[model samples]
Target: MSASSSVAAGRGAPRQASGALWQALPFLGIFAAALILPMVSNDYWTLIATRAAIYWVLVSALNLVVGFAGQLAIGWVAMLTLGAYTTSVLVAGNVMPPVPVFPALGVAALVGGVFGFIVGLPALRLRTFYFAMTTLGFATIVTQVALAWQGVTGGGIGIVGPVLPAPFDTIFGFYLFCLGLAAFCTWISANAAHSRFGRSLVAIRDAEVAAESSGISKPRLLGAVFLFAGAMAGIAGGLFATLQSYISPEAFTFDLSVLFFIAILIGGRGSILGPFIATIVLTWLPEFAAPLVAWSTFLYAALLLAIVLLVPGGIAALLDFRSRRRIEADRTIVPRPELLPEILGGRKASEAITLKDIVLSFGGVRAVDGLDLTIEPGAVHGLIGPNGSGKTTTLNVICGFYRPETGSVTVDGEPLPAAAPQTRAASGIARTFQTPKLIGEASVLQNVMVGGAIRGRGSFVESLLALPRHRQDEAMLRHDALLALRCVGLGALADVRADRLQHSELRFLEIARALMLRPRFLLLDEPAAGLSAEEIRSLGGLIRAISRQGTGVLLVEHHADLIFEICDQVTVLNLGRELAAGTPAEIRAHPEVVSAYLGS
Candidate 1:
């Protein structure tokens, strides 16, 4: 059988539903045990199990912020404390009608969201160690305030929490109540991880510049994740307080915050089930080691250190390792036959990009000197120069990565309003980097999916709920992305990890991703950098096909033959200044261009 047919047959042979069921069996078993444990186990074990459920809610939210969003917020415990204290104050003061425990939970979420927003404002500005330090500072500040505030918080003494009416007041009822709530929170997180928002977050975590170039707003998305995580922490806190029937400053500490971080790291950062499993293990480990009480804390620390040192991807990585290899071995790439359209049929034609008297400098060095260039629609405009001739720098200036100190960049006749990567991308411009910036851990399909982040319309809530609009957008996105991949000869490799691609394949993958934008103008930097002679020939054909589609192409290439073959016009630069510009034949025949650039 052909390789493509074998791959298609192998994938089509599997019962998708049965595979999903097998994957979910562990979670189902856990839920079943949670339901029956209270009846079969002793009271102490039941209490431990109940507390584990609450921890699961908090840790799951943390996973989104830390794992996928790539924010190290160790101060999440402060939000939890705020929620518990808010519930305590309301119940003790009899401020509202006693309508069970749900109202208190709602109030806690509001309070948590507000505080989270407040903290995220300053915290999001910093990254890595600095961000962690800022959050750690907040944790310390909040703890001190809780201890010092004698009037409302009852000071170091503490306050009592309201009972959950009658039925829920009992241990069995409360255990069941927490289980249901934990499941709901887990469901929300699982949905977010698979949605467009989740993909954007992962992209931001992996490559901020690439993510922004694809039109994702990093700060805005991170703020929203911080807000959601804060709300979840608050809800978990309220439940904890109600279960214990008391709240004290001692319960919420910096140590507890670290524990939450440790749980997710040990379980796995990005996976949905990792935090749940980690919480159960960390919560009950101490109880199980009660006989060795003196060494319990030491044992916990040692185990965590071992996990960090041994399995950096967490326990989830180990479980997925064997399955991953097996899948890769069995997978076959099926090439798609449909090529990019010869003409951009119905799509609006791109206007010319004119750079007038462009001059860009870095200190004493002028990377791009006063130069005028124009790129017309439906043509390959090649930019050629020696090593330091500023070819790539000129592209950067045009694409908004660099702003020329003395030049006006215009589309058609109007000047661009801003020089932000996202803004340019939104204005019908897309680009590929010299290094081929694909997210290594992401599947080829997912890396391409990031191309349509803004184009895919749906709110975070709508996505979580799987609303009609969200589903429709997702389906359309998948189909379009697959088509783009096929056009670049990568349709069959969509399920493969991007890191596994060969050097030449990575170049094509980058082009495929850019094509998903349906860009009016495409910027290609060193698109022919690492390709073999045969690949370069194929690339020439692809560029021609794209240009015929009425989309403008700004190609920066070192291969003179390739440039002259496909490019209608060529501009040559020397020492950061343009030396010659004309039709390919005219520029190639110029005496100075031949002597200084083409070769002696």
Candidate 2:
């Protein structure tokens, strides 16, 4: 059945919050266990728990980069070591009187952020193993420097971290402090996993071009993530130094780097609590297996291999199997109509997009040659031509995906910044690709939510904190996304994964996503490439509806019948140059267009 028709029949109401509560029950149980264990455990066990808490903080931080952002950062230990050394040197060298615990923690965070920014700046440009190797180099350098810097770090011996103030001086107090800090870190990590920043990171990780087009700044967000993660790692390091009352170069080894790296892998990437649990188990597992001390390294290696091979998604994925099913089964959603006007009325005043003398070439081929087009608000302008006529290239240039070798693009009579895709998108241009560009793993709703990102709902900080602004923005985005989905007749399947969508559904979903942006202009590449005649008719109606909402649509399509039936104006291209420009009727009658594109 058609998704919307099924929705009208009331077949897809969202499931209750009970499903969500059930999913979270295990984590709540774990939290309760964590609290009670400290109260009942012996001193040795308590110490191990405390150490696990510290590593939990570090592992969670690393997860943001490796798990969420998909940046393989192995140099986090450097930040951790930096925090330890910075705190120890300050207190031990008497550079400052042994500050209170909170203040010491603050200092460690600052140290971590500073070094993290430095490392992230250069590393953001590289991807995959190259980035990993860069981080590995940074870790090596930091470890070597700690060993060599005798005056500051006490050479290989290392300086001592300051003890906590009187109230926290006892072992129980320290353990409590570690537990509280770990809990705070967990909260932040969990918040980030659902925040705008998190979504943006995942978008970038999955599709860089799509993320950029959605107005996400790759470098800025990544740098911020690295800085935040680094600060957290540093905090963990500072806490560890205080817990042990000692620090040394030998302690922060490449092996330590491997451990932190493995913790996230064994737990699962992109999960907040998964890595937290992995950190605890990995931290204490060796202590429990004291008899296998000599084989500990081999055992860890085996475990890593096992997790990577047998359960590549890690323990969290296994636990989340049921939750995944619940997510898939969730179709109980009410239609949101309030956001219709907000999305439809994208442009208040009349706006026009003008492309003048545009020329874009790749190597020796002139993809778009001296193309001039005008798109008026409240109109559909179709650009049609034979294969390789540069229809898509022209749209790319206008939307800032490709910079023209020599030309200018103006929106509402002002020069549009075509230097970056994000800039163009922010300036009221949104686009859909020839092939549907959607985050496969993300739900249909989430794919649309990405479009609403340009609406300026909240800041990164507000998103992370889940503040009122963030909630308000999220609510608005969700409402608008539903409206957009309904507009394209896919509201019933909003909860479905984008990858599971049929080709026709995907095309409509892409249009719905673009509409969520409430864009002044839309660059649509082949909206009817693979659709039935009925679907094409539906798309034409949707395009006209969008035009009525005052959105200027630049459609690059080959479906001549659909284009002629709906387009207010049409521009025909052939061999990188304009073949004809006029109303659909005029273009159809043009001799040159018929010979070149229409094959008369």
What lDDT would each prediction earn against the true structure?
0.80, 0.80
Cα lDDT tens digits for candidate 2, 1-600: 235444633432244235446656766777678788867888888888888888888887778888878888876789989888877776665565656666777888998988888888765578788988888899999989988988778888777776877667887888888888777777777777766677778788887777788888888888888888888888888888888788888888676787788888788865776777788888888888989977766887999999989988897777755335534333322323343455675356656899899998889998888988999988999999989989888877876778889999998788877767888777778889987878776778888888777675677677767789887676667766777898788887877768777788888888888887778888889988888787788788778777777788888888899989999999988888988899999988898888877876
TM-scores of the candidates are 0.92, 0.91
Q: Candidate 1 residues 1-600, lDDT tens each?
A: 335534643564465346557767778888888898988888778788889998888887778888887788877898889888877777666455543467878888888877877777775578888888887888778778878987777778887876676677888888888899888887778778877788889888886667777888877887888888888888888888887777888888665787788788788766777777888988887776778756655665787789889987787777665227533334322323235662134688768999999999999999989999998889999999889899988888877778789988888687875467667777777889888888887788888888878888788878767788777667656666767788887877877878777888888888888887888888899899988887888888888888888889999999999999999999999989999999999988999999999985
Error of 1 at 484 (Å): 1.6
Prediction 2 TM-score vs. true: 0.91
* C-alpha lDDT of residue 284 in model 1: 84
Give Cα distance to truth, residue 321, candidate 2, Å: 3.7
